[model samples]
Target: MSKTANAGGHEGSAPHLHRLVLFSDAVFAIAITLLAIEIHPPEHWTSIADLFGQMGHKLWAYAVSFAVIGVYWISHRRIFARLRTANGVLDVLNLVVLGLIGLLPLVTELLWEHGGAAAIVYLGLVTAIGFALAALWGYAAFAGELTGPVHRGEALFTLARVAIAPGLMCGLIFFALNHAWGLILLALALGAFIAGGRYMRRQAEQAVEIDQPEEASA
Candidate 1:
């Protein structure tokens, strides 16, 4: 009787888990699509140079927004990949993450329009998203049933991955204060992201190695 009940419960949770991941994926897709839609070509340009010059900043902003959204989407996928089940609190946190993601396009527009002055808002939004993601991961990790056995190193590394955006953005905030800093901070942010990614990958590899020996001994 207990075995039957356990089996039934697992069956029921499977669909719920699938739906949660699907819904999150849909939100990510829409947010990234909206980013491109926010960019428009110049209405009246005398020449190719004029067209390129006019659209330059918008194009740059679009690229930055696209990359940021793309990274979060990948991170989201990683989080859900380990998840075995979802709870009400997890659902709420997921919604919070999605809500922040949905706002990226508007923030991107703001950054393009007002330049450095608007960067604080943009950075702040990104920072919030980062922290939200970290919180979501933290909750899942704490609730043992929501995920399979999470490796200690992997958990710490995942936290670092989510922290990269907020940490770097906070530093960039100081630079964003000066209008003259312009795209330099954007370039620096991207560079830091790349470096951070490499570091995280190494950490993940080490985590797997650490886990494997323990599992084998067990």
Candidate 2:
């Protein structure tokens, strides 16, 4: 994407892109609300006891998926925050990303009920969503569709980091005869957040280095 300012020297497409961002936000908010409906609180003591016994596993899976989608939304907001404008490609990409994300409830429910290979499949679906998101961010960064001085390195780092958990978890499903491997996947998801946060911090530090020469010269 051309970094040059428009002839009038203002960001060309803010109004349109800003609306897109808001719309995407609304959709995400709705989707997250929907995710909560899948929890199915235990109504009877027997059911409650049974659920509590299995709740640890189901809860962990739900939390993992919940946080996974939440993180993606957070990163996407940051990425789009840099946009100069939105284009047809970006709109389509956004739809695709949201479409994939919209599948989370079904996938989470499948994991909660079936609890073996289905759990792995759910993770695989999430991984696919992550891959699509990474693609979307890469497109925005390279296209200069971002609204600000976005750090491409930081963007790429975030994408790669977000992708690791679901990808690895999908692989672990084969040995997940029970929820054994699913727990492993949850641990990896936590690691992904820790690693991504650290990477983003490093990126921020490097961003400061760009102003060093100007500071020294002054």
Clashing pairs in 1: none
**Per-residue CA lDDT of candidate 1, range 1-218, in tens?**
22222342444557777888899989889988988888888789999999989988888778778878887888889988887776667778899999999999999899889877887798888888998998998877764347776666667668766856654754454456465584588677778767766776787778889889999999
Q: Lowest-scoring 10 consecutive residues by lDDT in candidate 2?
A: 1-10
Candidate 2 — which residues are off by over 4 angstroms? 1-12, 42-44, 47-51, 54-58, 144-147, 169-218
lDDT: which candidate is best? 1
- Compute the lDDT of residue 97 as modeled in candidate 2: 85
Off by over 4 Å in 1: 1-11, 166-218
Query: What are the lDDT figures for the candidates, one per model?
Result: 0.78, 0.70
lDDT of 1 at 177: 47
Q: Count backbone clashes in candidate 1.
A: 0
TM-score of 2: 0.72
Provide the lDDT at 11 for model 1: 41
